[model samples]
Target: MFAGAAPLAAQFPSDSSEPLAHARELLRETPLVDGHNDLPWRVRELAAGDFDSLDIAVHQDSLHTDIPRLREGLVGAQFFVSYVPADLIGNGAARFALMQMDLIRRMVERYPETFVFVTTADGIESAHEAGKIAALTGLEGGHAIEGSLDVLRTFYDLGARYMTLTHWASHAWADAATDEPRHNGLSPFGELVVREMNRLGMLVDLSHVSDSTMMDAMRISEAPVIYSHSSARALDNHPRNVPDPILRRLSENDGIVMVNYSPTFISQEVRDWAVTRDSLVDSLRQAFTIVDVTAPDSMVVDTAGLRQAVAGWTETNPAPRAHLEQVADHIDHLAQVAGIDHVGFGSDYDGIDAIPQGLEDVSTFPAIVAELLRRGYSDEDVRKLLGQNFLRVLRGAEAVAERLQQEMDPIVATIPP
Candidate 1:
């Protein structure tokens, strides 16, 4: 399709009229890469509804995914994640993996030209080249292999480019970020998994692993890695958020920390309030020793307005402009802490319920750029945060992948848990 092939000129508002035009023009022309998206499962639900036809007539704001929204969002390239429950590990992982892959394949078959099933880096470029949004695959948990290295290889062959070692759940071979006992970093077999994944050319994602696990896995892996969707703990002290020291090391190793845009991660106040609220409520329960008494208050969230919603919720939320502004700040901060070359955008859109108000979905990317510009981010730095930095790390991960595959047959990689 030609550039003019897009109905963007006729179907939507123009750059001149839109308030966010400056950033929009830059983001529209640049490649906006989001590290993780749960659209495969969403596509599964939408396919039942015929996503090509969004008939969520009863509730249009169901989920933050669909073709019409994608078009409206104007995202250039994306990774549709195949996330399965980690409990499905051991023997059933491959079944879940096949089901998700089948869903992606069906999506392609249902909308051939609108989506491109890309395998190679060139294929990704070409898909976007053809005016189609490039849809690549990412497996959210390593448990998708069911303890079989052969199954892991099959997933790589089927076009999975990245795999998170663990999910929020523990795996037989690895520990997880939540509730599980530690596994002394990667198990011996888990280390083999990392070596094999390096061989397979798949990028190892670390968005949901424990800190101890993260350090240990980093030591064994030969290639650069990515925390596909994590924030700066320095800003918000959540375990999910990577700290400065880790960020510094990731920078030194040529890895990346794609900034996640979930409201909880983006706003410290929100996290604190949530934590405080829970703690306070828990205290009340123990005080009364009764079933507890915090129901109506917990349910009463003032979504009546974004301002009201954020007033009590804005922990580190700079103005939305500052949100974008700090996004640049984070880019610069991570670069300062990690290195100028390592920060990237891994906005976790759709997977979360809320985001920075003005910047709700992928389409609002231009607003971020506009904010960056207002804060004096040159076009050069703008390009790097938008996608270039992530691409560089991806290329490096791919390089390491090829080297490992030649050295070992099964690609075993450890992930977060």
Candidate 2:
């Protein structure tokens, strides 16, 4: 966006500091936290490797996340999602969920000097003060509980802080953005889930819910909610993006929607191109019938890979920095629609195939801060977007949980005579 202003050599003159030196300094001052990332699940999937030797290169070998990379980005806390695909939830999902959680806990326990497990806002603060990356867990889909509150409570007892009501598949309790519209919104049982979440002190995440379902959640939830990872529907009109009306409601209720970093959710052009690529792949598959892709063993069809392939695909066919700017555009839109306080960063690392340009992984996050600073955001405002807004929501969630738990005598009655 800062185009033709000055020559590169002039901007980074040997006689003077880099033009962005101040921005870089401020970035270090900011406490970076991401709302959702599936790195733990990915790590679990590849039990094929050693986790102890994980560094930036090994982390980025497959996707976004690794200890060294997180330190480079100054990421203070991360809500590593124990995400299991919806269909896998019933038979193996629950066990996988437990394994993923234990993996995260073990990771922190082994690296006590580099990481700390945090369950509360205060804990996050203390861990940050101790110079460690505070790790938190959020169940990406409600189905992980297997349609039982007992299991939900057990997950919470295991350090799960929040749960998205539904995933791509609709559950008995709620509809997903990708579901076939059985209930149109939350079911009666879904409302009960909301109340249960309220009583349990866990945040209800609306990232993958439909528009009607988002409103339903905001209306019924006793605590302020979060969209763990979503973008602006106004920009791309994808089901994954939230509309302004819902954004306004999130703002009113003091909730936060962590902006996602998926390229398909950012630009219609990228989405269209992805469609074209898929069609091409289909044609080739029909013609040859030997492995879906000919581009070696690692030919990812998603936009991120397509952007940088053997043909120099996305790299040669660059979708302007404006496509990336649209990320900030959503930030601006949310500030206008939901108030500046309600928007935060929730990059879908390890979960999505394509990342928007300029935001490939954890280390590139300072680039986002630099972009925001370039757009005239003050240092204070940037800090909130980075982590403070989410911490505030967590504090409010704690209060709401305490108040709501008082009204549920059954959970307390289970304490025995």
* Stretches > 4 Å off in candidate 1: 1-19, 43-60, 87-91, 280-329, 411-417
For each candidate, the alpha-carbon lDDT, in order, equals 0.69, 0.76
lDDT of 2 by residue, 158-247 (tens): 999989888898766678897787678987767777778878878999988877788898999878899999988887778878898888
Q: How far is candidate 2 from the true structure (C-alpha RMSD, Å)?
A: 7.0
Q: Mind giving the per-residue lDDT tens digits that candidate 1 earns over 47-156?
A: 65254554322224666655666666666678878878767766577687788887777676777667888765666667766878778888888778877677778898
C-alpha positional error of residue 344 in candidate 2 after TM-score superposition, expressed in Å:
0.5
CA RMSD per model (angstroms):
8.3, 7.0
Task: Rate residue 123 of model 1 by lDDT.
Answer: 67
- Which ten residues in a row are the worst by lDDT in model 1? 1-10
On lDDT, the candidate that comes out on top is 2
Candidate 2 ranges beyond 4 A from true positions: 1-20, 48-60, 276-323, 410-417
